[model samples]
Target: METLYDSIRDKTRVFERTGVASFSETENGVQVLTDNGKRVEGSILVGADGISSTIRLPAKYRALVGTSRNQFVENPKLPFLARGHMHNVYYEGISGFCVQGVQGLVFWCLFFKEEAWPDPRPASKFTDADCESVITKYGHLRLGTHYTFSDLWQSRVNASMTVMEEGMIEAPWNRGRVVLLGDSVHKLLPLLRRSVSQLPSREELAEAFARYEAKQRPRANICISMSNLAMRFETQDSWWLRLARRLVPSIPEGAWMPFFVEYITSAPRLDFLARESPVGRAHDLKSR
Candidate 1:
């Protein structure tokens, strides 16, 4: 992230420890107000903020929300969980593990169904005993060969419980000069790590946003549907789905190669870029 920040430092002006209070469109440009009473103006405003985006509220009146609340299952932590690599492990809906700042210190999270918990309380509302009760209930499950849910829970430097909300705002990704990007426009299940690709370049800001939505909406819908399906298959105790899950692991790896290859090859691509041959020349050999 530092490397990325450094690379863009020349072209980017970053405002740290700042909160956006409001935004408006003016004849000159888009204007943003910070909580500190400072105002900034630019030709266009892009909201790259995450799921709880303030910019998204104006785009859609409502969003389609989904959630996965299930019993525990374990997998190896993300490879980047080790020192010098920054990332986290999210195993389906049951738990997410991360190592931050301090080396070898891992954090785990568990989310409960709204019906089961009933109270819409913040993480601070839960006590250590409350967290322990949850761990005792599901900690017997395996996370990896080396660690059970309990093993990680017991070794945790810290722990928290929270709710996960997933959804996509309805169309109209932009309202006048304020456009949306990243989780602000589309929020998918955690199963898929990648976000929508970079917005294609266009001379007009509205045209750029239009092309971005056109390119991303279809792929986002596909991912959302698949992620929902996966959650249901993994979390629901339905007989057929459970049976299929049991059999899936035992199947040989190469059996799904054709389907995997097709899915990858058919993935959406930005249409504006010229196709390139293996040698790096434009395949059509046409000048832009």
Candidate 2:
């Protein structure tokens, strides 16, 4: 993250200590106002500010619903249990829980289905009592043989609960000279570990945004659907679903290895820049 910040600062003109208050499109370009009442004009405005992006708010992009929380704890045995010092460990349950080891601390999350917390309030509106109540309900579950959710909750120094909104801004991501990018354009379930790729070069901005939407939208939608399906399979109490889940892990690895390899190899790729020699197309052509 620091490397990304440094690269942006070194390569681009940056505004420091300035917050965007609002934006408007003009005949020549886009006009922006800073929180302190200063006006700045530019040919293009890129909104990469993340899920609560001020830019996306004006564009009518909103979160429908989700509940998430992150907590940290000390787990000395984690390095040994996770070979090669694997950082992320996810456990499937009625809802999914994840433990990520980073910088000598274990960061974990509890994801609840929308129905679990249907209040529709912003995550910030949830109080410590609310957080504690939810944690207590699931605290008895074991993360592994030795660690339980209770252990992490008791040791937590800080935590937050948030609603994960899922949606996409309809095409023509740019209106006049103002455009959107990253979480501003689309948001997905966090467990998927997906994100919008790099922006196109300035010279190709217009064409690039169009291509980005066309290429990314289909794959993003597929991932969102898969995530929703996985959540339901893991969280729902339906007898058939639970039975299927139990049986899935019991299947021999050899039974699914070929299909798994095919799926991974055929996963989508983003084409932000032209390639001198594309490698995957010939294999795809031969298979076809």
Winning candidate number (TM-score): 2
- List model 2 lDDT by residue over 152-200, tens digit each: 6676656666554455666666644455666665663111122343433
Candidate lDDT (C-alpha), each: 0.52, 0.54
Off by over 4 Å in 2: 1-21, 51-93, 96-109, 114-131, 141-148, 155-166, 170-172, 187-205, 237-240, 254-263, 266-288
Cα RMSDs, all models: 11.0, 9.0
Q: For each predicted model, how many residue pairs clash, with residues at least 3 apart or on different chains?
A: 1, 0
98-177: candidate 1 lDDT, tens digit per residue? 33344545444443332354233443355566567666876666544445557656555455553333467786877666
Instruction: Tell me the lDDT of model 2 at 80.
Output: 20
- Stretches of model 1 off by over 4 angstroms after superposition: 1-4, 7-13, 51-133, 140-148, 155-165, 187-203, 237-257, 268-288
Q: lDDT value for candidate 2?
A: 0.54
Q: Candidate 2: minimum summed lDDT over ten consecutive residues — where?
A: 59-68
